[model samples]
Target: MALAIAVGLLLASGTAAADRVPLPALVKAHRGEACVEPLPVIRRDHMKFLMHQRDDTVHEGIRGARHSLVGCIDCHAAKDDAGRWVRIDAPGQFCASCHEYVSVTIDCFGCHAALPTVAFRKTAE
Candidate 1:
């Protein structure tokens, strides 16, 4: 009976660990840019594209939350100094803007660098 209880406890602990949220890795390198920096650049079409990408289970997963919790809008959905839709600094700021109100500590940004520049690549001649 003691052995069975121990096994059950171990199984429960393993299940709990598996339920823990997983964070994505940071964007350390980008298109040959060693010191990849964050930039705010928002495009309507790009936003829509991401919306589609997440909503599409074939590409991501059911509801896409498993693939990425912060769909494009979660970070890129903001207005600029000119009152135009644009990405924000620390893209984590966008997340914190909401999470702070709820007093939630987010570790997602630890491994994942919150930068608007993470999405695209520039081609130079």
Candidate 2:
């Protein structure tokens, strides 16, 4: 009877651990290519990289070829059912998905456009 209780408790704990919300599925880039960095690297250090990129652009006027938030928006922006581009904060959108899953507040849209630029939209068209 004690062994049965121990097994039941172990199974319950395992189920609880498995109940964690999984990471959201990221939309493919407009060009259907891989990201600038690997998934694990971006997952761990993307905020650090974005901050550095922001500083360089703001202070030094040197926007690197990659790692800019604008670049990410250009690539990851999604379209609505009506074929109109949607903002990053929209539900199921690229940025919102992961941010919502992790319960993190995103402040980028407060200062920057949440959707891709007109030029980017034209290029995709």
Candidate 3:
């Protein structure tokens, strides 16, 4: 009871910024600053772009690089300690970390490969 009161007093005094929860750590994209859209725009509209791209690919039979899931996996997939590529939707991985934090259901990997089929090495600088 005493500990709880102390915590409450600290919070009520504005000493605790209640909204300052740590966000999930995101992996850097392989291409760094070469995303199709700017960071803010992409963070806000990535779902919309993915859905639109899905519609076009499935119904219209059109596939392009601009918003392709393949492109995303290729660019965002990280490596394991053994040098194998990790699935994008796995826990702590690119997709799962954020989606879990935001309470969003991730259904994309249900019918799609979460890791690229081909290997992609970072280019030498």
* TM-score winner: 2
Which digits, one per residue and each the tens of the lDDT, describe model 2 over residues 1-125? 99999999999999988897567787666754788889889878999889889888999998745788988888888777888888878888888888888888878899988887754554657
10 residues in a row with least lDDT, candidate 2: 116-125
lDDT of 1 at 63: 62
Model 3 lDDT at residue 87: 93
Clashes of each: 1, 0, 0
Deviation of model 1 at 51, angstroms: 19
Which wins on TM-score, candidate 1 or candidate 2? 2
TM-score of 1: 0.30
Tens digits of per-residue lDDT for model 3, 20-96 = 66678997776546878888898889999999999999999998648999989878888888878889998988878
User: Across residues 20-79, which tens digit of lDDT does each residue of candidate 1 receive?
Assistant: 643333322213322112333221143344455556754655564422434433344444
Which candidate number has the best lDDT?
A: 3
Clashing pairs in 1: 26-111
Tell me the RMSD of model 2 versus the true structure.
3.6
TM-score of each: 0.30, 0.77, 0.76
Quick one: how many clashes does candidate 3 have? 0
User: In angstroms, how far off is 89's CA in candidate 3?
Assistant: 0.3
CA lDDT scores, all candidates in order = 0.45, 0.82, 0.82
Residue pairs with clashing backbones, model 3: none
Candidate 2 TM-score, true structure as reference = 0.77
Q: Give the candidates in order of lDDT, highest first.
A: 3, 2, 1
